[model samples]
Target: MKQLIVEIDETTEARIIIAAKTAGLSAQQWLKRIIDEKTVSSWPDSVKALAGSWQDVPFAEELRSGEGREKTY
Candidate 1:
């Protein structure tokens, strides 16, 4: 319910109009949807499952402590 004014190149403006028409949305609505998609962030279930998964991996603490890097350099 807020108003915004943005200046875009003619080519970009044309592309937005075409895409919005193709998607059956107004250009304003299309741009708002695009912004909403990009601005929201959430971790997926698969990634959340990875939490603490590394704890049981062999030598995880050694690797995290830079043991290999000290030996190589």
Candidate 2:
């Protein structure tokens, strides 16, 4: 594991400590979780689980079929 050194103002450091405490995590754990969330490349599980959930919504192809679009000259 690599060690990271950051220089933050006292107020910011206090805020991070407070936030970590509120989340029931150490500052390091909270920061690691935040970094992981920020660096993620794929959709989170909660969002992926929403796929095919909106049965009434039109698909991309249906919306692009130009059914109600105005004709151009």
Candidate 3:
């Protein structure tokens, strides 16, 4: 819900536009998703114990507990 002014390479911007359209999403939305993925959360491993039923185990958790979070189904 905020406006952002970012500079991208001309060719890269065009490629993002085409890829976003092919994926049935707007360019902004596609970029937001990518940004969200690369930005790691600061949540500690102990936080997982507080996250009830939360899946997708954090990388930190995998190392501490030696229990990877892979969907059984």
TM-score of each: 0.58, 0.72, 0.51
**Alpha-carbon runs more than 4 Å astray in model 3:** 42-73
Whose TM-score is higher: candidate 2's or candidate 3's? 2
Question: Can you list the residue pairs that collide in candidate 3?
Answer: none
lDDT of 2 by residue, 1-73 (tens): 9999999999999999999999999999999999998999999899999999999999999888997889899
lDDT accuracy of residue 55 in candidate 3: 61
What is residue 72's positional error in candidate 1, in angstroms? 21
| Model 1, residue pairs in steric clash | none
Q: What would the per-residue lDDT of candidate 3 be over residues 1-73, giving only the tens digit for each residue? A: 7898988899999999999999899998899888986896877677766865656656665666745556575
Per-residue lDDT of candidate 1, residues 1-73 (tens digit): 7788898999999999999999999999999899987887987788899988886676756668865465644
In candidate 1, stretches whose alpha carbon ends up further than 4 angstroms from where it belongs are 44-73
Best by the lDDT measure: 2
Top-down TM-score ranking: 2, 1, 3
In order, what lDDT does every prediction score?
0.87, 0.96, 0.82
**Cα RMSDs of all predictions?**
4.4, 3.7, 11.8
Residue 45 lDDT in candidate 3: 77
Q: What is the lDDT of residue 15 in candidate 3?
A: 98
